[model samples]
Target chain A: MQYIWINGNSDQGVSPDNRALAFGDGLFETMRLSGDCISHDQLHLHRLMDGCRRLNIPFSQATAESDFKLALAVVESSAHKFWRLKYIVSRGATDTGYFCDNTVVPERIMLLEPFTRDVVSLQQHGVSVIPCRWRLSHQPALAGMKHLNRLDQVMARQEWSSSDIFEGLTADSEGNWIEGTMSNLFVVDKTGCVITPRLDNCGVAGVMRHVVMNTLCPKLGLLVEEKNISTFESADEIFLTNSLIGIVPVTRLADKTYKIGQITRGLQRALNTKESGL
Target chain B: MQYIWINGNSDQGVSPDNRALAFGDGLFETMRLSGDCISHDQLHLHRLMDGCRRLNIPFSQATAESDFKLALAVVESSAHKFWRLKYIVSRGATDTGYFCDNTVVPERIMLLEPFTRDVVSLQQHGVSVIPCRWRLSHQPALAGMKHLNRLDQVMARQEWSSSDIFEGLTADSEGNWIEGTMSNLFVVDKTGCVITPRLDNCGVAGVMRHVVMNTLCPKLGLLVEEKNISTFESADEIFLTNSLIGIVPVTRLADKTYKIGQITRGLQRALNTKESGL
Candidate 1:
């Protein structure tokens, strides 16, 4: 990392009693930083605040904005040309238990790392994905919030070590295709209609996924559907999205091969235009 | 907290990049330390290793044992009469991402706290509990491992703040009674049979639960049954167990009141004998 900050102070370490480490009691946001600008800063902050509310962690938008500004200044002072900013809000340190004192100030850890566009080629030619044998447990109580209880994702990511596999597509225990390891999945049918997995049960409601459904797709005159998608057999195209790697098309999954369809390309171009403007 | 140790060294902090803070990628054991000995040290270590295997965190028994020994020594030299030893093993610090390098040696944080025995009176007269509205998500992949993704428990614990309620009983998403916010639940039938919720879907397979099922129950001539226990209507007695609080009888839940039954008392006596010998 080029820069690190804790609760807006320059620090690289956290107390062992931090609730984030104790009980995965926190939320985090990872955003793509181009120069001094963060992509979809408002949306990221909105989601973080939403998570804090649901998890009952105290969050102040003003304080977070100030911290972001300080982190950006630190990044600017560094020699890194491109950056990936990670903002973590944990329930701070406590007196050695799960019962938290809500009055304690929340701890914020901000990290800025030199960006490496590992998926640049994958975005262009599309990437390979595999069906992860591990199924995500369905828990609506914690669904759709980007809290730190991500053992499910960590286990899914460990299913494969091959560099060739860009991501692993995981299903819920009930056999519904939920999402990719680190991104949201969108599939296009032959009729040009878009469908993404409904995340009411389990899955991160990614910021990029929100952008595609609410902004880009509507602008392009496409209707985005959210449902329990079981099979990719009916899909004409498939892609993944995250804040850092806006959109990545999946070219192959096991024996099935997919090509970059027109809708995928059009969405990609639109997203590029929007990102470039940012 | 009286003392803290990280990787066998006296330390109070961890890197912000530590996977435990970032993703809650860790497992922890809260063990009761009586005098110079940690109660059920073997069972605690066994469960920790099992958690490591299930979560794919690299674990060395010798390293963990040595760390535990050093931490115990620190506690022994301290002035505290009673102690609680918390052993945590995280996937160490990594490049900012969920994708881990399995070769990285896991980080160990051992915390020593002066035990307050906050529930001593409750253990005698029995404590009141209420059913939590927040349901535990069912993820078979992460069901039994006492890994650090305990946001479910934290949220459940936060549901009630009444000092009269000592614990909250949480159910799985499907309405099956699973466990307490911090302990495992057991129900005894009038026929002298003991039933604990089947943890195939969700709930921490606590070390104390293991000891009760494997070692103590059979010795007391109790046939322990693990099944989907949906209702406590058939229960003649109710109790909870954890490493710190061995076995806590439940006197009341909502309007339903229960007295300390014969089987519950028998098991409690057996546990007391075992603990006293330790």
Candidate 2:
């Protein structure tokens, strides 16, 4: 009845020598488990595999599938019924510095926790965000991969703590819009075109961001483009997306206000239909 | 009796919920131990304290002094002599996301290992290095701190594994020189002005680099400059520095060759006089 599982066992704690703890040599996926379904699991697995390939951690597709199944079984057996699952893959434990040894086995740790985000309230009456002074660093090698080197996001989150502020939008060093501290952002221009910042330089390519860009927007016939977005002042509408909160529109950013436009409502409906409780 | 200590105790392993494993919300200092001495103790402590302030992790001066004293005591009690000690300060363990809670108690894990390096041969013959395809990311927020988000360094280390190659030179995305994979880089030009890449934008500010810049070069009355160094073709000498390796000169880089210059030899002598078996 344990909610934590490390390498398919619930008894083992994390090793002090784990490369994740040592050098952040790992990847992680935060997925929403609603009822019995994990939302957009294929996309999560795809990104995880891509991260593994980039870091050379040797996480095979078969191993990911097997681990996912184990995670599913553990979630189903939970007595308290968990909602959020953080699946992590570390480059195991090693005393070596900066060297990714080929002989090292990857360690997977899955933790399920009870989560209750008031999605309906937030979606209906959007969320207020602030502009963070903290900017993201551009590393094309590690960009867009949801790896564990997230000190940037951690720093960005410290920018705002007001109860009214739902998130803080962080930009790159050049002032180009990157993403929210915990979610992906979308900007709708006056031409009714949806735009998200290009993640080739920084920011995570979130699972739900992929869903909106590839599925919901296409289903609604709305044109979405990915580019370097700098100003949000002229944006007709704005919204944030992540696995936990499917699509929460932004109503206020600093002093500027944005209407929860037609596109946002449309995407919200589409996401609701796709992910029931999300 | 133990070579490892986590918060003054040796029995506890790292918690699975550690933010270091979760988001790399941590800082670490690797210091060299010879007999009863830890090399450049004040510099390492200063860096660690500065890192805590930057990350907003509440660590008191009294606590750091206490932990350091405890670390020294553990080393003295060890039957197996330890040469290398890695002092880690994680943002502790939490199930929460990006927003760092201020009340969180930072976890300190100190690991001591028996490390051996043939310093004389490498310092005399010098080591060969190659230019890395992997580049460092520019983050003003994290520049110069020896934090745990070292995936850039981890990836850079994998670029060359030829036993003959000791390190790789990693530049920033704009092709400006940053640092070596594991050590700081210094290039002595034709006019005898020693230049090292500025770490204001990126790269770890190593303790040895600080010692060389602030102490050794001044002692020799040598002209040392910190700026953007792109080409090494016109360099008279080159060297690498870290807590573990101290000052090891570079004899070969890619196709070009360099001699172990008089400055390197002088600095080596100064360092030896200062730190006896370091």
Candidate 3:
């Protein structure tokens, strides 16, 4: 966040009355920026635009696409090859209450940081995660959109400070398995069918999840479907996905150890091929 | 926000990486300021501290009390007798993922705005409301704390745009009546028992709600309790509460008009007396 831009300008901060800060009335996309090109830029754009539309923020994908490109151009001079680009669109500054004036402009905040991770990206070697005690609220209205109201994620992540754990598997209020703290969850069952939780209840419908389901799964001739997954105990393999981390296989959960299954390795290889093509 | 203070300083803005903007990982207190005094200052302080503790933000009531006082003192010279003081406490600036540094200090942002309302207060002659189509999610972990994630309220308030409507009554995902978009709702039943929706599931446990339940009701010898209220048709009287607006009776829900009952008038009088004493 040291290098930040609000609506393509440096130095100027987000207005105090911005709805993002007040009510978390906003949407955001965190994409991996490699040198010049953005990974899954199109998918990220679609999700952000969809989120803004769901939240009733005045923004179009075409406008956001130009803004994303403009943001990349605005920071063209930066020498870092890898950066975590966080683009936020909030219902901009308003002095009113929950009732927003229809004509209020939306805020576009882009934060760029040199890509850093405390948890090693053991993409092939895999990472470990524990079940989170924090539960996500079930709101079909706000679910599936990557909106800014993520205190549930924050709380879930706060459960463990030990760097030993990479992520935490979270469940919704009704005890249905949902996702990881910062990544999307995928469970490979004994029958080898890929399973991800239904985002129609509660969870961020991540761009990478979309890629795995729509792009990679079809490429590999695999059956990937969303269902109410309640346990990882019966899984033959487990993994997590995010635009930043690509695909991270879950090698262990609590005391149980899991081998990097062939399917996971295949998906990982497929993701590498896909990303390289991008 | 024409006038704002970030930890008592003027003309300064919150850092771009403030968690409030990023994840809504913060707490806020919108207290009413009159001349030089803050209304329901103690209750707001209590709730703020409780929320900070619940969210794991490093803030105590004593520090917040001093900060709250300092903010009041810092803006002592202002001529506006009535101000809507929006005090926000975020997990401060952090350039990390969902995880946070334990040493990061919580930010104290105070925004001052001239209190203005488009809808009439109509405290004596109550206001009309409509049921919101948007529903609240049930999260016991976050219930009752006025944390920064208010997208539900924003969506609920978006259901209507007419100035004729005061506030929209919101219900939980299970179709249980919860509260208003900006206020806590209380319903007086046929038996004269005052019932407010329980906040243990989901909904803001506003300070005025606390006062009406703990102070005014007890003072008037009325039986007030929390329950799962679903409809307004059976209610003998309906009312809403928030710190700034105090207590506003609901005279009509859609087409059904209701009389300003004796219980509502008595409670309103009691609240006035209590505030005068303060």
Best prediction by lDDT: 1
lDDT of 1 by residue, B162-241 (tens): 77888999998779999999999999998889999999989999988988898889998889999988898899999999
Task: Specify the highest-TM-score model's number.
Answer: 1
- CAPRI band of model 1? high
TM-score of chain A of 1: 0.96
lDDT of 1: 0.87
Task: Please provide, for model 3 over A148-265, each residue's C-alpha lDDT reduced to its tens digit, 9 standing for 90 to 100.
Answer: 9999999999889998899999998778889998899998998889999998889999999999999998899989989988767789999999988888889989899998898988
What DockQ do you compute for every candidate structure? 0.85, 0.78, 0.81
For model 3, residues B24-121, the per-residue Cα lDDT tens digits are 99999998876677888888888888888888899867767776676577446777656678899998888758899689888878787767552234
Clashing residue pairs found in predicted model 1: none
Q: Of models 2 and 3, which has the larger DockQ?
A: 3
Give the lowest summed-lDDT range of ten residues in model 1 chain B: B116-125
Per-candidate TM-scores read 0.97, 0.96, 0.96
Residue pairs with backbone atoms closer than 3 Å in model 2 (clashes): none
The per-candidate TM-score of the B chain, in the order shown, comes to 0.96, 0.95, 0.94
lDDT of 1 by residue, A33-147 (tens): 7767778999999999999899888789888899889867766777765688999999888887778766888999989887877656767899999999989878887889999
Q: After superposition, how far is residue A72 of candidate 3 from its true place, in Å?
A: 2.8
Q: Pick the winner on lDDT between candidates 2 and 3.
A: 2
lDDT of 1 at A32: 80
Interface RMSD of each: 0.9, 1.3, 1.1
